[model samples]
Target chain A: MATGRIVIDVERCKGCELCLEACPQDVISLADTFNAKGYRPALLADPNHACTGCALCAVVCPDACITVFRDVPTPKAQVALEV
Target chain B: MATLTADITEKLVYQRPDALADLYTHYCPGCTHGTAHRLVAEVLSELGMQEDAVLVASVGCSVFSYKYFDVDAAEAAHGRACAMATGVKRVNPDKIVFTYQGDGDLASIGLAETMHAAIRGENITVIFLNNAIYGMTGGQMAPTTLPGQHTTSSPFGRDIKLTGNPIHIAEILGSIPGTAYSVRRSMHDARHVIQAKKAIQTAFEAQQKGLGFSVVELLSSCPTNWKMTPNEALSWVRDNMVPTYPLGDYKVHEELQSKRGRGR
Candidate 1:
């Protein structure tokens, strides 16, 4: 089954560590090296396969650097129109 | 299945609030703090600024405002909400910053910080809740308390000879050059609540546009402190407080322009 994904904007990330602590699925990890701003940005170790898209990480991020996209069921209209 | 009606409660709910330690609020029943909290939360949710917005919670009853608000909040010392908010906004210019303060915090102890922040035209919003009496610290007389009002400190009713007159904070703030928007409204009833919401939303929008300081003074009720029932407190606010405060726009940039003959 497909799942939603979490994307982090590394440049804007302030390395607040809020998302690192908030992600219940334990799929997010900090980068080994710091960015230009000298803060280690958050990254997804594994994609949505392990992410639940609960949006806890996005809510806790103080920099507003996280975005979540969830997979949706295909609309019936699309199937009917294709047929 | 029946179609569900989109209730006002649903629209006002905070969908994306931050998760900090959740402690039970210590507000009286029918207290306007809950409504005020919801208004701010709703605005943050609408603007998608909840993640970046940092609220400065003042002392007095609202000292624990950070608990109720679902955003990044920091507790400031008594009457220093404006200064704390100033530091936070200055350090992080991209974040939407605001201060939640009471009459005592803004008008009495923190008066200097509040005035200077307005004079400097800091790009922030100050949600000033004026309930006449201090709520958190056992109902003490505040700077904005009504004349002849009876409070813990003014047990025998505020004496004009001793307590002096009530301070008109909104009118005073409106006169400042740095203030971009200043509106005094109330939340006594549904009608006033609507107006209060509009004023609050406008202040938030002004911040979003990077405009200078904006303040919305809400005439709230304190039934527990006022020594009256909830309904009576609302009535007192409508009959007495509104007259002294006088609900209306005190200053507008367009008026300033015309007065300066810029339009002519």
Candidate 2:
């Protein structure tokens, strides 16, 4: 199973709402909580399950705000006998 | 017999630009509008703003600019492209905003919008194409139309007593305090075309940096209106229009280094 992560850089964000529209899975939203500049920054909800790592959000972001990372699980290693 | 491979130059001519849509343009052959579209499209691709950029096209031969550019676009009312672009930029500040207009549209009907946008220092790129005549509306006199130049409206040759002299839009816009960068260029020949691309890239870079208003005035040729072949039309622009609309950087902000400098 793969998990998705959404990271945002609040400082560079201009509150353009482009990522909000670009999110096809509707996992991204803008919270009422304001950043240091008093502008509403984008917030991600249910990121682990809802986001498919489509990367549309990253592509449409004019200020290049959001970055999506897909976590792929690694295979387990076999134990060696010490006889 | 020796095996021969296709030369890179031959491949270059066969490869079509991906940024431009596969549609037959309505512009006349040898019209500079096609070159202008290609330049803008290439810039959008180079900056990776193709998807995020929204172009506002004004009424003119460039009104169909939306058809050629692969990016998102909206057709504005005649001469209202600047006003529409202002709204789009404000609403979606992140997306690259641009307005393409002709001399008549920018210097005449949309004069107020153009002046205000420059004065307010809107962070948008305006591509002003000055062919000196109203191309789509027939060979009519335009604000940038040279003095003593005959058109359909000025069949007896433009008279200073009747029709006023050409307006230097780039120079006038450069005088405004809010304008960050402005350049007047031409596409009469290969050399001028290269210079024009540089001017256009600068204008787009200014917008990307969120700098104030940027305008690139291109003194284009109108062969149909001039009643000459493509070559003659280009020669006429070089000889006549260059004297009236000299090519150079009218204004640039020495203090601003780049986009990072502006943001800081």
Candidate 3:
């Protein structure tokens, strides 16, 4: 399984909630607190690691405040073959 | 059984457009200006016009258009963006020139400027944002405001007789023989946002080809001025404004007809 991370430019986010709705994994939501601009920034809650890293939230973000990154499992060590 | 160990590497899937600065814009929450800025920046980046664009920023909430775009931009007087862009495009023939205007600036005060620019076939792109109100000036009724639409100036709903009818800018420009491309799109949803970007691409391509005046009228939402929640404002655009302004291609140069569908 793949893991994903969301990076939010808290200052740039306008709390439009478009990204909250666009997140297929429902890991995004509006934070209870406000940013320096007196606007609520979007927060991610992937306690169960349900994020699939689809990037739909970033695609629909008007402010371009969100960036999505995903990790792919690297190859494992190979075993030597016996003759 | 031996456990297999592996490493994980993070890869970037999506990031902000480079044509836009890292600074936060001053637009109100839920306003489409942010989306509009993103789309224009994305188009310029895609067309490789980051260093070769001249943006004629107009008055209104978007008066600071120069701040959002990383390219060379100049602020134009109220309703004079088209005129300024004409001069800029003429002097810098190799650069991609464009004007980001609102309804109040383009349709009402700058009507003559916008009309004459299209009539003269100026080789420049015009990204017109029609929110049907003077968003920066406290929500006054704009020239494109629909009949019976309530605005600060029309508290009791717009009177069709006194206020006159809403102007169809895309249709008007599209009908003009000099206008090479014209279309209307929305930013209310993700799918339409993608479509809006395609429209921007086609418009820029027309300017790059020197096909003459091209316009993309964007049906934008003003959540703050409209006095509606952000999401409700989007629904209003899809349900209310779309009917008044509609959306589609009003004109396309014969040569660029095939390229229009390339974005799809």
- A-chain TM-score of every model: 0.80, 0.76, 0.86
**Model 2: chain B TM-score relative to the native chain B:** 0.92
Of the two candidates 2 and 3, the one with more favorable lDDT, higher being better, is 3
Candidate 1 regions off by >4 Å?
A1-83, B1-23, B254-264
Every model's TM-score? 0.68, 0.71, 0.92
Clashes of each: 0, 0, 0
Best by DockQ: 3
Q: Write the per-residue lDDT of candidate 1 for residues B28-57, one digit (tens) a residue.
A: 644667557656675677678878889999
lDDT score for candidate 3 against the true structure: 0.88
Q: For residues A18-55, could you state the per-residue lDDT of candidate 3 as single tens digits?
A: 88766778899888899999889998888988888888
lDDT for residue B241 in candidate 3, whole number 0-100: 88
Lowest lDDT 10-mer window, candidate 2 chain B?
Answer: B5-14
On DockQ, the stronger of 1 and 2 is 1
For each candidate in the order shown, give its overall lDDT on alpha carbons.
0.74, 0.76, 0.88
RMSD per model, one decimal: 14.4, 18.5, 3.3
Residue pairs in collision within model 1: none
List model 2 lDDT by residue over B123-195, tens digit each.
8899999999999989899988888898999998889877667899989999998898888988776556657
CAPRI class assigned to model 3? medium
Best model number under lDDT? 3
